[model samples]
Target: MNSMKALSVIFIFFLSLVTFSSGDLIEDVCGTSSDFKVCIDALRADPKRCSTDKKGLVRILLQQCSTKANSIYNEVASLLEQAKEHVLIQCLQICKENYDNAIDDATSAIKYFDANDFLAARTSTVAIASAPDTCEETFNEPPVRISPIKSKDDDFMNFIGLTMRDLIEDVCRTSSDFKVCIDALRADPKSSSADKKGLVHILLQQCLAKAKSIYNEIVSLLEQAKEHVLIQCLQVCKENYDSSIDDAETAIKDFDANDFPGAMSAVSDVVSAPDTCEETFNESVKISPIKSKDDDFMNFINLTASLINQFGN
Candidate 1:
């Protein structure tokens, strides 16, 4: 976790929705933000911030907002499935419904923003921004239960207050599974201005995020395992995930240093981490406790490798 966080520190600073003059778009837009330094860092990392116009940047923001809402929706649903308490379940249910609306509103905002309908996009943004409040307030009601998804809620709102990668078309055309390629890019705003090398960079980030998420979950699951088969599967999974994290970070560094083939080779090793993990559970005849996480990571790593395969073709 520390290594992942340390590696991500270089990329974490990004901007949200705002327009500004030509002299310093990142500076001007980020300056308007409530969190100045954080905003500055985000836009600073974007090599295209100065060249990309205001409209393009805002479109990126809206698309990212939509992407994040979908993630939050899925996360809430997962939490809802595990909640045993009546009040907690009820709160999650409310959050689930609200996030569903947020997903639509943020998606709608993208279309409206794209169509030059600023008024409507603003309207949608208003609806998008309300979701966190509604969800957070639901947990604050009498017999209050802490929202299991508070971090997600806060991040969602903060997005409304930071934001997409332009995806699918060209970069995905050569992907083995085109749809999976698109899905892998859903949460990446830098993709809007990224090229082939850049897309690999984004896909590697996606793969790493999924890998890290599943690895953390495995750490927790290991603390509770009683079945021998499950423990054995999880132990193997931990080993796979551990190596995957190292490979992904190495790939990212290679990409940054212009060693494209080296990056590809590293990520090729990465693609097997989830596959091996899943096969362990399958061979042992045990349903993987982290099935969704495994599948999600698999999807990301596959796309990362597939796109890298197409780079020289």
Candidate 2:
């Protein structure tokens, strides 16, 4: 019985040593971050998942970012609904959009991380780091200054930025794709934009380019389709794409002029074009003989529609 008790004590001692060693390693890894305290606190809050490696640290940070983004999105959405001042409403709308984009970007970062594409993950993470700043910048203009909102967002963004900078520095020091990853993140339009309006401009430009590409592809596909029903469906799809392009162009004009609501409304129209095209095919009395091709085209159209919808809300 004494020998067994001795063995149990030894086991407990070794287990404590292992736990202390893990905590020390976590501290060392977090010590390299810009906000070591924040990093340590965050990681310690979920010690089971926070391993001692750099990748583990990044994963935790990304998870935190995703959670914060979702919370901010909900808060901003609620605030927007309650807002009455025209300028405040516009600012809140922009904030809501930024938070939504941040959530999407963080989700993409997680996906890239899961795939071991650190460069892509870094780019998405960096974009998310800029979201709070982009939202706060909307109130920097004349007669719309909201000090409390700006202050809160600024502090939150600083925390996010510090952690991100630490992650980027670690990646540059350790990853073989250091230069490529850093360069890609630095050039990301979402991360580099100076303000909400600038970000909107970039989004609109990308949307317009994508819309044009989809339009061209559909037209080219329509020319090759030999079946009458397939041709008719493709033609309808082409017409929808054409309308989407026009609406996208109008959205760009609205965005450039800082007419955000107008831009959003126009982009919403662009989102609906694909659905209208698909509905046309669905309403046809005769079932499409080229059912497979019809489904393929419709799927493609839906994807394009979904992409455009992101730009608006």
Q: Pick by TM-score: which candidate is best?
A: 1
Clash number for each model: 10, 0
lDDT winner: 1
lDDT of 2 by residue, 101-121 (tens): 888998997888767776676
Regions of candidate 1 where Cα sits further than 4 Å from its true position: 1-168
lDDT of 1 by residue, 1-313 (tens): 1111111111112223443576776565545444566555555554666677655544544455566678778989999888898889888898889889988887887787777776566557656656787888889889888778787666554444332122234577777677878765655544433445766788788777777888898989998999889999999999999999999999889878877788889988886788899899999999988888778777667767777766545
TM-score of each: 0.46, 0.44
How many steric overlaps does candidate 1 have? Answer: 10
At residue 6, candidate 1 shows an lDDT of 17
Q: Which portions of model 2 show Cα errors greater than 4 Å?
A: 1-23, 50-54, 163-313
Q: What is the C-alpha RMSD of each candidate to the true structure, in Å?
A: 17.3, 18.1
In candidate 1, how many Å is residue 170 off? 1.4
lDDT score, candidate 1, position 89: 89
* Candidate 1 residue pairs in backbone clash: 13-41, 13-42, 14-42, 60-164, 159-162, 164-189, 165-188, 165-189, 165-192, 166-192
> Which ten residues in a row are the worst by lDDT in model 1?
2-11
